[model samples]
Target: MSSFDAEALERAAKAARELESSKHVKAAVELSKREQNVKVREYDARKAEASADAEKAKAAQIQIAAEERRKTIAFERKAKEELMSRQQQMERQRMREQDQLSRQREQDMLEAKKQADMERDARRLQMEQQIQEERLEGARRRAEAERANIRARAMAEAEGRILEQRKNEDIHARDIQRRSEAKAAELRGAIQEAFSQLSSTLGSYIKDSTALRNTVFVGTALAVGVYGVREGSRVIGRVVERRLLTPALVRETSRTAGTFGLRQRMKRALGMLPAEEVGLDGIVLEDKLSSRIVETASATTNTRRNGAPFRHMLFYGPPGTGKTMVAKRLARTSGLDYAVMSGGDIGPLGKDGVTELHKLLDWGETSKRGLLLFIDEADAFLSSRSRSAMSEDHRNALNALLYRTGEASRSLMLVLATNRPGDLDAAVTDRVDDAVLFGLPDAAGREALVRVYFEKFVVRAGEDAPRRLMGLLPAARASKIEIGEGFTDEYFAELAARTAGFSGRAISKLMLGVQGAVYGRGEPTLTLEIMEDVVQRKLAEFDERRRLAKTDYTDSASEAVTGTAADAAARRSSA
Candidate 1:
């Protein structure tokens, strides 16, 4: 065992130790490897879990990204669709605007055409109216020219006719004048022969009783013959000339003519005469006469500063009153030239009437002698427009008369006689300076007038004859007698008393009627029987006229009263 064994043991022991240490190290290593392996396994497990989670997160991210992409695409698509819709709406709006513009243009063109057509129609109508007016004006002008030609022809024809009539009248007048002159010359020769014979007879008578008686007788006879011849010649000359030969003869003729003419003209113009002119003795205007008129005229004349004396008078009265006779007397007393005019002569007063009146007035004014302008029935010219129912022409004539009367400044007298004073206008009355109111004659006036009439008709009887006749008949009966010679103052007085309320005109008519009755009986002188018969007839006529006038007056009064009563009743009712 020794040393070798010890060595081997040691070796073995060492080997054993080594072997144990190897086992321990191997076990430790194995344990350490197991622990490490466990740690690694845990790490691997954690890693694996982490890796799974990471993978999940990545998957979620991918899903989210895809959703975002889808959303973006959807948004882009909507925007594009909206843009297209806007474009379509804009295009529709443009189309509507264009359509409205076209309609407006068409309406404007139609209105312009209508206005042009109306203007053309108006112009055409105006032209037609102008042409019609021109034609009417031309027609009127032609008518006026034709009327002027007709008037000229009528004037020429009228003048020719007037000239022919004048020529005929002139020839007749000249022939009458020549015949008168020849007769006058013959009368002168006869007068001269008679004078020569008278001178010889006177020479033969010279001294001695017997011879003286013979010579005286012869000379006386010769003287008578000469006187007779001269008287005969004058009578013949007057008849030939149709006028009195000398101034004295002419004056006598004029006096006689005036009485007859005045009576007739006055009766015709005024329808009446004064009692004096009719030969009835009565006072038409008692006491006063023409005093008022004379005074008024005198006053007017006195007021005149210069020119000739004014003696014109106008007498206006009712029918049967004296006007013309008074004028004639006035003309005779005043020594004025007298001319008579009838109102009827002025009726045809165109230019001719006016000219004649002017000429007559001028002649009167310019004459050396005082002229009397006597106009009968003056109311015919001076009548009121309302009363006369005058035409415009008549009124114009009256105006002319008024002008001449008012402006007259000459020594001419005018006497205007009228029956109707009421019919004269105020202007006419004012222009006249004097007016005489002539009324019906009273008993005394009528008697005086009758006497005047008797003097002209009956030859005057001797004083003894009138008394003798008065005794033979009753006083009233004898007075009514229409003596051929004019009545005496006493005879007219008795007749005037019997005929009460009789106008001067009626009295004169009665006288004429009495004369007619006497003449019918073939009696030379008027008798009482004739007078009575005539008076009875006239009285009956007068009574009838009065009755009719009274009846008319009564009826008119009744009507007026009834009208007044009815008017009063109506007025009361209205109130």
Candidate 2:
């Protein structure tokens, strides 16, 4: 029963347990085969013992013992051989795993070297790019320095030449002064001699004709007084023109094209200063279309494919929606020289309209500053040529416009504004680069316009700004129309909301009406009720105008239909 015996099942079971714990599947399988072989040998031993007993022969028993010994030796040899074979196979497998691990490590090392080389090459390229950039920057700086030095030298030379010319001018001026004084003295002597002769003749007339002497004396005295007055007025006129008008015009001119044309001076007299007209601010930008057009024009003014600015644009919208205002802003924000003319003004010139239109285009081109020619109510003259009512005058003007608007001149932009875009000739629309629509303001726009009008017309222009900007005054100026304290931005917003269909002009007019109503009554401040009453009146007026326009359109269409039917009947009767 000792486990030391080869036939013990406990010994085989211990070996099997050890093999399972070792977790070598191949070794476990070989142990299981050996266990089966042992079972077969035990069975063979039992069978041989049974056969010996059945025969009851001693020789047979002895033979069976010898055979069993031989089989034990063979079984021992086979087990030893299998153990050696399993050990050799395990050794070979372990070496293969070690070799695979070593190869993996070598591959990882090689990949690391490749990544390091790539990083080094990238760093080298980056350093080279930096060095090249530095060199280019240094070269640009040196070139700028050289240009500045050259400009300095040229300016110095110009200044020296200017100084020499000024000295020469001074000497020439002195010579001219001497000659002028001499001529003045000679003229004075001649005037004295002529006056003495005239006095002698008048005295003889008095002595010879006593009846007419008093009348002649009075006439001579009156003539001398009139002559003195005329000369004095002439001198004053020259002084006023030189001292007052010239400097005033010069100051105003500095803001414009450096000098004023006669027409521009006339325009200034009519209270249309270009700078003031284009000086609108945030409130004017409440309309999205207007602001977008203004912003687009300003942004693209200096854009370049190769090189070019914004070309021509068309502004079409309802009346009082600020087409002309947007055009002026576009011209101003782009810093272009602005010229304004109306199509209505041009149409009255008959055949001369074409000439005047060409003159305008020529003037714009002649001024080196870029020109923005804005024509308001353009449909008046730019009407379709195919229309029955197209006058010869408008036809000629349109032809000239087509010629001038071919390709925009150097930095010249033509802006046309029309309340009736459908009336505009196809040729005009085709020449225009961009057309922006400006419709009536919505709620926000109305409120902004109201605020702008109130602030501009009532607050600032009236007397209230004195209190707001410089603290409360002792008394308002006599000319000031004071704004009531109750009328605030909220009041304006409410009034604006009520004014649903009113244009900007109508809102401004409402302000004007309130001012008139308040000022005529001699009230120092305007009440909110007064403002509301004025707004109601304006709204009524606006409604009336709309109704009239609709009625007029309906009447005209019906008349056209009636006239056409009558004409057709007349033609049938004639047939």
Per-model lDDT: 0.62, 0.69
Off by over 4 Å in 2: 1-280, 303-309, 462-478, 488-490, 550-575
Off by over 4 Å in 1: 1-285, 290-312, 386-388, 458-494, 545-575
Scored by lDDT, the top model is: 2
Worst 10 residues of 2 by lDDT: 246-255
Instruction: State the lDDT of candidate 1 residue by residue for 239-352, as single tens digits.
Output: 533321222101111122335666646554543432222121222446676564344434544433345446445576556666766665555444455667766567666555
Question: Against the hidden true structure, what lDDT does model 1 obtain?
Answer: 0.62
RMSD versus native structure for model 1 = 44.3
**What is the Cα-based TM-score of model 1?**
0.40
TM-score of each predicted structure versus truth = 0.40, 0.46
RMSD of each: 44.3, 35.9
